[model samples]
Target: MTSPPQPAAGPVSPLNSPLEPESNRKLAMLLLAIVLYIGVLLLPTPAGLTPAGQVALGLLVLVVTLWISECVSPANSAVILTGAAVLGLMGKSLTPGARPMKSADALAAMLGGFSSTAVLLVAAALFLAVALKHTGLDRRVALLVMSRVGISPARLTLGAMIVGLVLALFIPSATARVGAVIPIMIGITAALGLPINSSLGATLMIVTAQACSIFNMGFKTGAAQNLISLDFMQKAFGRTVTWSEWFLTALPFTASMSVVLFLASLFLLRPQVPPAAEAEAKLRAQLAELGPLSGAEKRLIAVAVLLLVMWSTEGVLHPFDTTTTTQIGIALLLMPRIGVMHWSQAEKLVPWGTVVLFAASISLGTLLSKTGAAGWLAQQTLGQIGLSALPVVMVVGALSLFSIVLHLGFASATGLASTLIPIFIAFAQTLPVTKETAFGIVMIQSFVVSFGFILPTNAPQNMLCYATGAIRTKEFAKIGLVVTVAGLLLIMLLSATVWPMMGVL
Candidate 1:
């Protein structure tokens, strides 16, 4: 039977008609952001406006394009931005030698992002996720989770979130994390006699929120974009975001956010009591279905632990670090003897588009820095915006907010980070805050880029989780709003007081 047509919100104006309202909004937003970007570029600068302004303008254009189509593919958008930069330089709009836009050099420069430990680590982690899935290890674990954890509705939701977060440390990709876990979550929730829609909805939203948030803090290779942001900060400012330091800086926020999320889940998904017999039977069924761990699972666990040990003690463990761990894992993945991931399967597993997007975005950021575009814009805009510390704080906050909003349009975190970090770095140049503070804010923004409460295209993981229908739009909004605000505040406190006391300032 055909489903009834949904009711319209209001009489649709030409601008609001369903035929292309969203696309039109996206077009308008893209154009407006581009216009604002040009304004930022034209603002008076010490060097008579640098190429960084044009670079920033190009990024704004990309962001707009992404918001509209939600299908341009972030990597392609990055490539286009690079092309625009070259054209601008060629046409003298960005100044001669403003950026290395030659195809050969830009291609080479963009590829450098792949060499980072962060990228390799994530690739390793993806292999690990695939291995677990292929071997049925994840199902076994999920079964154990449902049986060992209580069947109470509230506990189940929390359990699912925890599972998703833990998996992310090893899984790397949000899509994989949710894709692997949501089906299992739905099965377990249904077995417990809970409403699939509301329970699953809230749980999945929490999963997306927690996965992105914790990964932002947990490992060096937690997320691809985290590495991109780190690379930009270190290359531009000569700083290293050590795993220990990253964890320490993000620990308080992570813990606070996790707890807040748990409470938020409870409130949003009010768990009514289920029939005791039915719940126990469902739990028993799930547990009974689980079998012994397979060879692949055993092998993967051993390899994963080895990788973790190496990550935790990179300095002392035979000079291995995140990159080495990833390389080793990938090598194992390609080995026929391992039988974990064949070359063909492994090739499919790597998110090559994401890798390309990172490389291109970084190249763009680098181009801005080289052309003196970033510094010029920083001097022009920050000088007029405010000369005081408080104003700088507000600017950082606003940038963070802009990044989050841009998430609705940009599908990838690295895309947003690479596009914005250079501009932020430039702006911070005029402020009194240390480079670390500015970069730290940028790092925080990268994490927040995974936020997507309303639309499916916000992030890959968000879309994957949303497809499960476990979380509703309103429910996501309620929890996401709280997390977003709290997360921003946590960063503000850390940047303003904690980091200052630690001499990061």
Candidate 2:
């Protein structure tokens, strides 16, 4: 009656992984970056741009190549790109007819992102994720609700979507949210006696991962990249996007996509879940075992609701920006006796590399703008496309489709935003619209940066769920294509309608 031994797992496909940056590939990418850097420097500096701008453009290409290929660690690449900027271009002034740049002055612009509000918000958001993980409140919330959805295949799929939507508000880190939700989903799949790769299992996991991504567009704090985009916008235009405004700006689109994600998950993936009659009790029991929310859960929930309020009312009920409010909340969570967790425990759980990457992304994009490289590059590329001649709606569609295609090359949306948002900010400026509307155009494109649908490696959340071994790359890509198409169209539609009405188009 004993079962035979399971087969040894083979090598993981790169399509389903974050594609670790190591070996010959890493060296090759670095060499390519060098070739690109040298080539750009050798070319005649384009008209309307400074010699410093050309150097910055070369750095942009080289750094982007490293980031997308992930040939070097993000933090390392960030530092490398900035150092190269200061070292190579300190004598060249970015502004025509200005004093030649000094080392400290050039260095200051390169590191500007590290001091911005968006970077601090990103750090605080990670702390929020850590607190949830420390208290297991994230798991409890996910399981408690999902356990209630009947074991029907479609219902289970919808439950996953609902969990992702709810968690988007509570957990700012999409990767952390998926990490907490996917295993619970896999467990539910297992208790039903289904194989991990069952249509139902794969469908559930796919939707679980995509849901986390889809909702990242909804909240300003939902994704680290959103903060990065806001930082770029702030630096470029001196505008601030509040939590509630971001929510309202995004709600119609995110809401529509959420439904599209569900239909696509249910019908496209076609999860043929069987009636696992008994597993329902196992699901409920899992939630029950937590034994009536402990003291930590109580404190975490109370603080979370309050933080949610604080985040939502910024610029309306309070002048405290998202970063200030978030730091205040994190402070409460780290207090000795009254808090849910300690700095020692919370720090251990936080991904400090994210902070590095966030700061670096901001710095890279800021430097690109400061040196006029982003605008120059945009003029050479997007500018040639005659986007200004097209209606504002077409601008949305064009930039969105471009972002999706560019995302194929990127592993992190933060990197994508760094590489493109500045270019986008510049590109938007050329569009025949008011300055405010042009800023809105850049904000809209940032949402597309979150579209990590086509491949697992494209987003951290997608990769985390893919690691469960329940879904194949092709299956994930199948759904991603549908969502990508749908998301792009929705963005365009909103650009013409909702966004315009809000004066955001």
Candidate 3:
């Protein structure tokens, strides 16, 4: 495909550079955070909130502000927020007349998230992703699919997307899926001699990132945020969300959105040049290089299929929980003789930052709900916006829009879920819908939180693709805006029609 025009060379003057002011900007963000903290603390406590809840709210504001401005990395922000939560609870306990929050209680409140089953599941899933990468199976599958689809650019893109959807079934994490796919797509660009700035290169990269995020919604384990939401639902309302239920509810939207993403990429980021006839031959040669599947590949494939079957049938089979199944799968992958990956290699590939972020977010979300902050804020905000007066469908649409817009201010989907899901659960209580209907609405909001297409920082996958420099921020924004709008409309349409029919609303 034809490449975009290269930027003209310019002097490397640091002071006059556009990014030169970032340090000052971060400093300003810190200052703004301090001011916001003070402002929230100074305001009279909202009705129905305890002192602890108000303190939590202040901390939430500071954390959200710092995260949006990126005064620090998201992992660091999560750590800082965790510390704030601890100190806030401790400070409340120190007050003479206040109920005593014991040191053990405070510690449990902050550290509990680290011990979550969801966190453990993510850790195990990362091992699977690492095995796929180390064994080169991910690339083999990509090339095999491309070879079968031939060399047409549109067909290649479609084939890549289909491969992504299939991977989502077994690979739980979107970040992991992106890691597996990007290098293979990059190699394709190199094989085709496409310029880094070529339309085809950018399209392939953007498509891979976008498709990963879209398919993440289709399965229960598609994203860590999904698990977090399910956990919250169980704790808040004693509701259990099964794999089949999640699949049936989310698959329709995910499938439709995937089509929308494919069409959008095809039209908005179509290759500028047609593929050369030799492209198919090159892909076949690459696939041929892999030769036959090794025993390791066969073993990993067997274990992955077993894990998928277990996850899909967990509710009916009455076997082990999803977390246990994952743990068992990890054990099989690490078996001495049959293992496809070594611990040292898998350890290196494990995303510790994501683990920490997930744990901290879970801790923060638990605190927000337990402290009554989520409920208080939900009530006040909804009342202020007259949300309680609107029809349930309108409220759902409003929340869908709010969820999408709020994502712009947060870099991590799990972080956004931790912040918004609790508030949504509380807000749902204020609606006129039945408890089941309210839960369905909350679930919809939770799904929307993963729709992080509007900004590169909205998802790690987006950031990974953007790091290649093939896709500019404006270029991403152009497609992101359209996809986001389409997504919002789809959520509304489902909420009004499909959800009610499915008894979700």
Candidate 4:
């Protein structure tokens, strides 16, 4: 006999199901992190930490968790973190025998990120990128470079990487560089009649992303984290790392790694359709169609050249820092009819989320350093590693590797640096090395933190390319693993040889 029919199934309950909307899941995560924060705060203070430090640690734990989970937008998380810090400081002021931080000091600690030179520089750089895009200069540069490289896919890849390197020198923001380049590369792909998800398209996208990340290490202003690292160096070690010094120290390693990345992409991620004679014809046609640069492009070039000169000579000719010089460039760009673009146009291109995220990260990092939270955390974690018993080079390598592994949980390079740099500073002191050597080790660790290419969420550059649908996760992972391993080995080599020769060791 046939079995009786089952009753019709009812709608699934949200309380018992995992299939909630993404927004709902994110909200749950945010609430869970808040609860964790409260639990940590209410628990007894751990040894070797002040009450204020304990509070700061709790906030840091919550923020890091939220960031890693991406339970909220980074900007929103930053705002929440800043508010929590202010409240935590206020609570400390009310505690008996606590060293009460003044309200002004607390405000500064919570909101000072907005006033950072790095943040301002990034803002100005956004405007500059907009100017380049608005005047068609970015596209013109891309076509010019591609036209000269011929129609071979490998040659085009090299040309794109070279353009990325050149842009890194002047642009100073990896996201902006990717923003400027991806569209041009996409145009090239379309001109060649290649599908967006074709192997060639994927290769070009990955190359652009990888090149942006690799070259970020070559220049001090290439990434926001580089500036954060320098700030930490000056504050914690009484040492200043000028742009020229950073370029001198990091260029050797970055240039070599970039070559490895290019070769790896060429060999491992070879395109499905190699560039043909028609591809060259298409590029030339595109160039011929655009004809010559406009008056706007000419003015932008002058302004960009002036900005580059000022940045390269920051500590030498003018004594104006990178931020000051950028401000000057922005002023010229926005000045009357002579300006390349109006404020309205430039403002539209600015990535405001990045601005808020970096500012809050800097503020949080400053608090972590000032309140001794970073030091205590470092001592508790690395202190147990018995680093003193290991060779100095070995210790540096371990720390560098740890920084790379840690990036799996961090979406923002600035967040990773802000969290780890202070701890590395403390970890350096525990090593059997000179103060200068320790400083150098910390700087090296800072550089490795930028190697967040293994996952799409690791860096914005990766995420942007991933959005193109040209690359599959496994495809990216395959290349990312090779590059990451190569990068780690290179860092180890530098720590053993180049760093010592440079007196960083």
Model 1, 345-439: lDDT tens digits are 66675667766666666666776676666666556654565644565456656666766676666666666676667766666655666666666
Winner on lDDT (1 vs 3): 3
Give the per-residue lDDT of model 3 (tens digit) for 328-370.
9999899898788779878987778878878888887887787
Off by over 4 Å in 4: 1-20, 93-105, 272-275
TM-score of each: 0.81, 0.93, 0.90, 0.91
For model 1, state the Cα shift of residue 474 in Å: 1.9
All models, RMSD in angstroms? 6.5, 5.6, 6.4, 4.7
**lDDT ranking from best candidate downward:** 2, 4, 3, 1
Pairs of residues clashing in candidate 3: none
lDDT scores of the candidates, listed in order: 0.63, 0.86, 0.82, 0.82
Give the distance in Å from residue 243's predicted Cα in candidate 1 to where it truly belongs: 2.5
Cα error, residue 117 of model 3, in Å, equals 1.7
Model 2: ten consecutive residues of lowest lDDT: 15-24
Kindly indicate the candidate among 3 and 4 with the higher TM-score. Answer: 4
Top TM-score prediction, candidate number: 2
How well is each residue in 1-505 modelled by candidate 2, as lDDT tens digits?
A: 9999998998887755566445667889889998898798889987888898888888888888888788888778877887877876778886778788899978887777788888888888888888888888888888888887888887898889888888889777888899889888988888888898999889988998888888999999899889889888887788888999999999998999998888988887788766777678888888888889989889888988999999898998989988899899889988987899888887888888788878877877877887788888899999998888998888889989999998998888888888889999988887789999888889998898999988999988888888888889999999999999999988988888888898786
